[model samples]
Target: MMIPIRKEQRQENMHLKKTPMTKDMKKGMIEDMKKLKRYSTVIKSYSYMKAFRLLATSLLVALSMGFTSCGEDELDRMPSTSLDEGTLFDKTDKLFSEYIKDYSNIKCRYGLQGESSVLLSGLKDNHLWFSEYDAVSKQLKSEWIDIEKTDTIQQLYKGYGEYETLYVKYVAPLYYKEISTGNIVTFNIGGRFQTIFTSNHKAKRTQLQYDNSKNGIAHNWYKESVFIADCCYSHEGDTIYIAKSRPSFDENGNLAGVTLVSYEEGIELSGRYINRRSFKEGKSVWSTYIAPPFDVPSDAKRNYTLLGNTTNIWEYKCEVTFYDGTKRDFTFKINIDNGKIVTDEIKVTGISINENTVNLKQGETFQLTATVQPDNATNNKVIWSSSNETVASISQEGLVTANSAGETNITVTTEDGNFSTTAIVTVTSNEDEDKATLARLEGTWDMLKCYGWEYNDQNIKENWEENVVGEYIFFEDEDGNGGYNDGYKTYYFASSVEGNKLILRNSEWLDGKTSIIITKLTETELHLKAIDSVSEENYEMKRR
Candidate 1:
């Protein structure tokens, strides 16, 4: 038969009722109460056994006295005063119930339950001790759990026992999750990890950020709230973390605080950052240098710390990763030995231009260029590229040339591999084809050799120098030679009385004192001499 419940409390049990002590029931009844005494918080009088038996028999007889509504769940129970805060803890082997009290009294907001929940009976830094009764065990269990484990595989939908709920949300677009806003971050936080300063709001405000850095390559800072996912930045402009990534908006609502992240730089163990905090004003830099990891032992990078209310000197510490995964350290330490961060945090900001969309005309060439500079950064390196090789191609140093009639785009990517963009290129045909003049200059000619020199007074025959390529000038028997470039001296062919005659006239710059000569026009042989005034020089043309 099912065990009956207490009046007005409806608690269910698995006990077998003994028939009131007839001669046979007395001995068994004594043993049962003794066993009950071993587990019960309240001890009943040994002498009252007979009276209890009578009372129990009377209760069974009055079946009309219906059972009360007691439930077996520990959460539904009234405060158990019979519980010896000391012995109750010794049997359960943990302090889950006590954890609720200390945890709630500390008023930490991050999911530690209130007084109505499990009480924190004990604590060690990062390890917690609390107590709660398990229904199946029918006895309160004092629980001591490791308090600092925070990495995740899947997710815990809710908390243990009747404690506050906990969950996780992966915010990144890739299968790899990103640190997102509104994600509930829970830690094994031991009982001792609790403090008077403990507050759930303070702990969960730790936000995770997607940083372009080396040391902490796979991790993010869980140090702030994430109200928005994407942000816009200017070329070398300051990215003010306004309510959402903008700066200074006392009008659109003022800044609660700032988020400054950098490459491998993590939160320094000294100063205000050593102690964690929620988002607050002047707590960060306007610029963040996210490239390396801090002094911590993990690959995840974004480390954060708090700053004092009006200080401008934000110091930071960072680690440089060697090519083979080893790390070196750097520091921007703003000493807060006075127990507060007496400096302002700065954020390093930048933007990348899209470069994959370029167009051009046939036979034209261009140089591709990439520029990466921070609003406060110096000596930043950048890379450039193109979209199509068939239509247009770009050089390693950013030179581009259009090879075909089609269109293509050019792309420019950042060195950090954080961003990329493209530009358009359109090509048209060249329209100046008529101005070329080298189509008719193909021919062969040669000079001739002669043995006899018949020049009187060393005068050259003028007709011999006509239709030539070399520079020449016409001169008298005593003057210099004829001119060419500015104006070529003329070799005039005259037919006086039907006989061919030649005259070398120094025209343009040369005066009337010039030579006259005559020779039959031939493709390969010519004999000539200069005037006596210039020189007694004979000229011969020969062809091979």
Candidate 2:
């Protein structure tokens, strides 16, 4: 509708209508531009600061170089990054002191896994944290350093495994000795020593070779401390040989590095050493078991002898004889409180007789042997006795003597633990004679009178007599069963005949069985005398 207008005016009007500018929007744009300018300034300042830090680092390096190149003596005078030998030894000593509390209580058990040998060697080196001198001192500057942060020290500390816990429970230093050799200083520490086995099982070569993984055998042993020294040191009954490599020093006579050497011999306790020594507080009690410190052959024999007074400190001597005709002796001392010693002596556990049941004729004798449960029992002596001596008798030496044809029990009892065993002994005569004797006495007998007599200077003197004119009735059957009735009541019994003897077995009898010698027997009359009777009673009966 408008006439032809200028192109520039038309374009300007379209822009103003499409984007009308507000006061708030213009202020926001101005703020954003100021923030961008500040950011650019910050970037430039950061680049300048980086360049300045680089220059400062270069200057410090130059100064350090200038100081180091001053002179040979001056370079040598500089502080060393590595710890000195003395300082290292001091630290190791301190570490050992932390674990070991009582030197007399330390013990060790070895010979299973191969790693045990490595651990023993490390322990023998006084638990030296480092193998060679280095900048370790710079890192160990803190008073309480975390062992986990130090790799080398952590390895050495954890390598002890379960023994590390044991150290905290039962270990302590006894004493130490110092030996000087030019630039080398060796420290010898003394402590107690124990073997892998106690006196009960003993240390044997075969047992020591047992593989824990293959056998699944668990062994309980006391913990021991590893000795540290360059020479052999003997204390009490233990001798430890420790050796180490001398420390290397620089031209300025400063320690540079050190090496730990393996011991000359194995870590086994050898010869003689204390196994168990313990004291009870306020109880004056001391007990111990001693054995050879080293492993011995299986065929070896050991004998122990307890010496000294029981009321005071005592000593035990162990003598061993090997299969190869070699012999060794070891001695141990035991201390007690208030001059009182309490020892645990071996006791008999059980006893067995050679024969469980024995058969013998009258007047026959047999020697029986009793074997104790353990041959090494402190008291294996036994006492032998017979239940019914009237039928069979036993001597103190387990000799059985059949006095009459009957059955009796032969018992042997141990003196130590009162352990006992019994054997049944049955005495018999010829079959034909026994049958005849049993058949001849199978009827009821009249009342009887019994009398006991003793010889008074070659004159027969009746000491006691009992009248039983009609009060008693004795009867027997063809089957050898018999009993006696006292008019009011009747008692029954089982009987057997052997030679000129008659045996009556009844639970009512004191000894279970009664033995009577058939002095006279006939169809009309029967005379009986009790065997081994205190009263020597003779009974006379008449068949009714």
Candidate 3:
């Protein structure tokens, strides 16, 4: 029952001129043809009916031309070869048979024969005259031709159609139903029609069966096809098509499987339509869910719960059931600035730190934990920072280390919601106050300059100067564990302070041991003199 139309052939034939018939006419003719039990007799008489209609049209045109040159008396006389409108209407069956031949020709041209034929024919069934249908058809055909000639438009059409199919098949049916049944109601909002569901008509579970053999044919045929040229309703008069745009895609060019924008009469309303696919008995089944529009129905089920709010934005959660008995929770963010509503998956509401206030001695460490509300938030990652790293420093993993006798705030912020929580950390020093110098070195330092002389093999000191001002080093703790990054690779080392000298030990260093005399150390400035067997280097640094 599936039509096997080749893409290349279809593209080639799209430019060919043929009889223009709207999908509705094709369906009507196909249905009327099905009603006649004597199809063979109709086929046998198809040629005669076609020839008769052509002869009738020719005679009518010829008679009009002849009458233009005739006298008033001659116009009153009936032409022998011409047939009147009444006589033409009398042979309705013959005219209907002629239509059958036209429909058959269309089917043969488009490869619409069985289920594929029915699926394509049943797309849009609006009543329109031949001229009107032809104009619309030509406009849509030209748009499609342009789309085929452009890669971006072609991808947009394919992506849009994929999501639209899911919307038309699953989501729209549950949300927009019969007006007479009181399931849906339409409003004339700003000169545009907006439909919404009623409160009591919740979606019910329904089992659906689709022929697997028709999947490939239907999907491919519908991918590049748009049934209606303008804003129109489905054949059942329940669902409406207002606007369409390309779906979002990832950097790798994979479709995001969601439509992010919808327009109604030039008014842009942001919404998301997500397409979900599943299989049942080797048959493909699609399910889609959409966010509620800006204007929610007054009588709709009011099950929304306030999650959190800011000065201008309020976030709420609502659970809705689909036709397949599956329930989904959505977060609605209402912005007061433009009075617009947007929906996302679950979002972070609030955050909390384990310890509100903590007291620690110098060189002590404690792990501070942060908990994001509603556990299942879409983005729960938090960024950790310290208000004053000199008093206390916090790691990316929330490990706080007390440095000197001071107080600081350790804060954690949620990545998605920017919700933050802080813990006050106080450090009391019991060791010698000179150890406070280590606390001053517990942060990042920018190297100002390094100048020294290297003794060559001849034992002569050669001047070696280098500007390393852009380089940076991070001192983690009093124990002298630190890292240095010169805009390329970072090197880690352990150090110890002996009197006025700082000894650094690292296997990756040029020498296993290097000692530097701390010439100057302060809250803001650091100057060191590195001494080796061959040369001595003076380095200057500043606290960052």
Query: Which numbered prediction scores highest in lDDT against the true structure?
Result: 3
Tens digits of lDDT, candidate 3, 220-327: 001221112122233222224432432222332222332211121111112232222211121112322335644344333434555765333556666655555555
lDDT (10s digit) by residue, model 2, range 203-227: 2111111122221111111122223
Model 2, runs deviating above 4 Å:
1-190, 193-441, 445-449, 453-474, 478-526, 529-537, 542-544
Pairs that clash in candidate 2? 100-172, 101-171, 101-172, 102-171, 102-172, 103-172, 107-223, 107-224, 108-224
Q: Pick the candidate with the highest TM-score.
A: 2
Per-model TM against the reference: 0.20, 0.22, 0.21
Give all candidates' CA lDDT scores: 0.31, 0.41, 0.43
| lDDT-superior candidate, 1 or 2 | 2
Total residue pair clashes for candidate 3: 0
Provide the lDDT at 525 for model 2: 91
Q: Which runs in model 1 stand beyond 4 Å of their true positions?
A: 1-11, 14-369, 372-422, 425-544
Order the candidates by lDDT, highest first.
3, 2, 1
Clashing pairs in 3: none
Select the stronger candidate by lDDT from 2 and 3. Answer: 3
TM-score, model 2 to reference: 0.22
